[model samples]
Target chain A: MISIRNLTKRFDGNTVWENVNLEIQKGETVVIIGGSGGGKSTLLRCINRLVEPDSGEVVIDGVNILSPGTDINAVRRKMGMVYQHFNLFSHLSVLENIILAPMKVAGRSREDAVAEAKQLLARVGMAGRENTNPADLSGGQKQRVASARTLAMHPEIILFDEPTSALDPTMVDEVESVIRSLSEDGITGVIVTHDLQFARRIATRVVFLADKGICEEGTPEQLFDHPTKLQTQRFLYRSRMFEQDLSPETLDLYALASELRAFLRRYEHERKQEKLLPVLCDELLYPVLKHPEAPAAGASLRLLCSETSSRHTMMIGFRGIDSDPLEEPYLDELNLALLNNYAEFVLSRKKDDGWEVCIQM
Target chain B: MTIQKTLQGSALTVAPEGRLDTITSPQLESELRADMNSVTDLVFDLANLTYISSAGLRVLLSAQKAMNKKGTMVLRNVKPEIMEIFEITGFSSILTIE
Candidate 1:
């Protein structure tokens, strides 16, 4: 139950966005995504009056929050915001952090606040961790506590400003699951995130913010799969790529694997596809491209992981190698078999000064 | 990677913790090389082993070949991910895995 009419914002002389119009129904989880500096986070802030818009009204339940006559504090009490850096009080225990707002702001007794805090903690998968200090908690746990603290206000709407940005790749799923469960319970949410996969998973409606305004907005399937705008297509396509240059002499396979894992996990690729990454590095790159005797020495190698329209492909480009490792008789028989069994297709092509090997997964 | 070795007479049990990738495989290879001659039964406890590469597979292959001549070699607690690698490369048919 929120409506924005001709909303605009500016910093100094530069306009961030102009003439933005959007509507959010009750129980709708709306996700806002855009490039950095596109004012996605700023727009979310405008909703809660954290950043006052330069023009137009943000009307929530027929009350223009931008109006000075409106009771801002009363309106804010109905909305809760979770931030990227969990703004949990570092000195406080988990229980204290959650119960603080409810007891002080809502004028509830400590006994009542504590009882509700425990239930909120358990709901966010933080049960039995109430006594632990905020510093002792993981990034994901702290975010969950921040969410629970926000929920402690019992707000009608929750605004997430890049909720998973500070988390480790392995921990993103936990916080995402908590947010997802909240949406299932019919909590109206408006999220500002660069994480498209998270947005895809959580958003009932997706909005793309760019070029000083709302560029496009649609369902996840429509926006992600068949975006009518060229900018939206370019953004979604470029977002999935994981590119890296190889240093053969001091190559750390474990570090590479973990980095690749983190990148792939952001897009929420299947576990099977992720598992094959290390194998590709060990069996394909190590034996053929990175080996000392492989004639790829001093070569600049670029590995690009491309996810296009749900099809996953990895292209390995070797800048100095003349011969194709896939076609050469020197390629190990066992390695060939392994590659053949896993990959849908393995093809090689000559670029300007290098050979690119594309493996479809 | 940490290698925990338990040697009781001719039976040698080697437990490798963490990844058995390109860098650490050589360490495991050299560690096993030092005691291969006297050992009759080789047990690789892989409960704590989280990962393995083709380089690690080669080390196990060599170990199996060495044990075939004098004793027996068996792998214990092989993780499903590692087992998938073994099965793909036909190591499952060659190696004794538990």
Candidate 2:
């Protein structure tokens, strides 16, 4: 069990987060979700004393590791961190990578470390990659080896700092699956990531960090589907938009509308509102569905909708298109008029293959 | 998708059944291209169309552009779902939907 009481941190006079109090129960997978540079990773680092906190206590199992005379290395040994970039020794083979920590840090014999490393590699689904060098392996494979190395330490808690962010889209699921398996095995995990879908799948609890501390914390369903706080809702909405932009896919219009309606109904239920559906559909959903972009075959238009009591956010992402539809001269006036009338703000940006239009009302 | 054609006077009606997605849009495009020159009025009967993606919209845009010079293009019995696609892409204003 880890308890953070009034944990605060600052970097070169800029406060990252202040007075952040949170409790990670044993075996609970707590995911920290927030905007970039909001101290999500810093909170993880502070827990392991990698970035020393400005003030406050980081107590793990009644031991205040931040106190003077505390064995910081021993405390760190209890927490394993998997970085955004696979911080593996490129010169070391996969087997060597995993065994190095156990043999040197834990003082285990090379044979014993090798045996454990093999098992950890197998557990992380990298059994046959023992002889492969880190440079020779793919990003996902290297991350797997990194995870295996962390597991080699047999830490009670694993801190993941955007482990899948550096991976290719195709390889993200593989690493995520590995992390999911760890949660199933009852490992206490503190994951700081922008991957909301992954967090929803693996997190036992979700913490939204904003404005110097935790703005909201709840179960993934509660936080994602119906976030009570404004910051939580905005962060979730933006995070989903980013995810859509990265891997856009063609969506059935009817199915998407149905999903949006269902989401709105759930949101209304959480907010205890009556008669919000009709207004949302007519005002927000209808206008968003009206934007025109001519995408080539196999291209996709992805949509995401999120609403709070006072405002609504709709994100439409277009990908794999041959030409930018927003560049069409005929659409300039119409898009401007639509934005002026229906949305409080309309932001459109060029993406990899297509464009993204975000409408907030 | 199954396409049914009915010719009356100078109008040619192409009725497409099922989804007009990325895979099927070209089928509709080629079908229209073959007869578009002869027809003065182009009508798309979308009663049975269950879905339309950006791919489908592109074909429709091209058809509308072509018809603007020589003929009048109209989309009839447009499903709310398909209509939403038109509305989303600003195709409703460009293409006459009834």
Candidate 3:
């Protein structure tokens, strides 16, 4: 459905990428992955003329979208873009955000746009939040609303630029799941992201950009598991190690605690900081373990550790605990003080069958 | 878990040892209930107590609530581990700890 021929881009006499060629088929989900400053996002922008390429053509259907006389706004209307920071209109409510483009640009009636917007909001799991302001919503909720706004346009192709990059670790899954569901519905999508796990989940084809051009392109399994290029191998291996560092398998309470201690020590050593693990364990995990309702054995607790560009986080999930561990009623002044002193941010949410407590530092 | 109780004058002290879990919290509750009527000061010596669950917390809450009307309740020698439980669950403010 889309083809790029000899596409090149440069900034301040520096070549970002050159001679990039790729063919994207209808209903295909493609992901562009590369190291920082590789112009993965710049290439995505080049598709809709959001970033004008120095050379070459981006053809959708049969016409070159980059042609001088072509209608850029009309072309952009057919393509939806979801941004890293959500890019929601700060002044608009969720419903207004979704309905504005369709009503203003597409000439749809207000009632019609609103009806469609409600359906899109429900589809993205934001049914009752339509009246809420963007500032009032969480990062995850804003992203979902941004997606619904994009879908409200009813575009032929959607572009996602690191959509979950700005989200907290707990919020990443909800947004990823929404995007995954959209892919399942056969929406053609091109996403640029650093999240290897999310890239693997939604991609039908993967493209790696390095050294000012397209370095490799293959199925996700081929690119991630057995890349032929050295650059691809190195990138994938390093990201895989980082992911592994965060996800230790489920273990008994004692074993999990010990492993967390070791993990914290390693983290502190690597970052050259004082150890925060003992305090975390003392204030968080120990209480859960000693709580009479705690599960006795076997996958009772799960630990997820993630390090993004801006934050290092650990999420400890407790299953089979009947009460909410982080409920406001249960938090005393000391609990709040201890959490504030030890972590950058603390959030708790109830999952389908368990409670997840996330501590970010 | 095992419970040892001693009554001296108007004060009653109970020391519990081992895990205070769902299976054992009821034992502590019944023990507290049996002697709470005559006592004006309830003291828990938790030095030997190793663990506590929500069920144990419920018992403590009930004891604290009962003591609120006529008596004073204090927890002494709480291990660091047990102290953490109180902090996490917000029980530290509700129950006096020494």
Q: What fraction of the true Cα-Cα contacts (under 8 Å, chains A to B) does candidate 1 also have?
A: 0.63
Give the best candidate by lDDT.
Answer: 1
Candidate 3 chain B, run of 10 with poorest lDDT: B17-26
| lDDT (Cα, 0-100) at B68 in candidate 1 | 97
Chain A only: list TM-scores of all candidates. 0.71, 0.69, 0.79
Error of 2 at B34 (Å): 21
Residue by residue across A1-361, what tens digits does model 1's lDDT show? 8999999999997999999999999889999998888999999999999999999999999999999899999999999999999999998999999999998999999999999999999999999999999999999999999999999999999999999877754478999988888888778999998778889988999999989999999999999999999999888887466677775676666787788778766653566677677767776777655656555543343334432222365777766677776765425666666666666667777867667777766
Q: Candidate 1: deviation at residue A147, Å?
A: 0.7
What 10-residue stretch in candidate 3 chain A is worst by lDDT? A239-248
Which numbered prediction scores highest in TM-score against the true structure? 3
Clashing pairs in 2: A289-B88, A290-B87, A290-B88, A291-B88, A291-B89, A292-B89
- Using lDDT as the yardstick, the better of models 2 and 3 is 3
What are the TM-scores, per candidate, against the unseen true structure?
A: 0.58, 0.56, 0.66
lDDT of 1 by residue, B1-98 (tens): 99999999999999999989767899999999999999999999999998887789889999999999999999999998778878888999999998
Off by over 4 Å in 3: A239-278, A285-308, A316-336, A347-357, B1-98
For candidate 3, the per-residue lDDT at B16 reads 95
Candidate 1 C-alpha RMSD relative to the actual structure: 15.0
Candidate 1: stretches off by over 4 Å: A243-361, B1-98
> What is the alpha-carbon lDDT of model 3 when measured against the actual structure?
0.78
Ranking by TM-score: 3, 1, 2
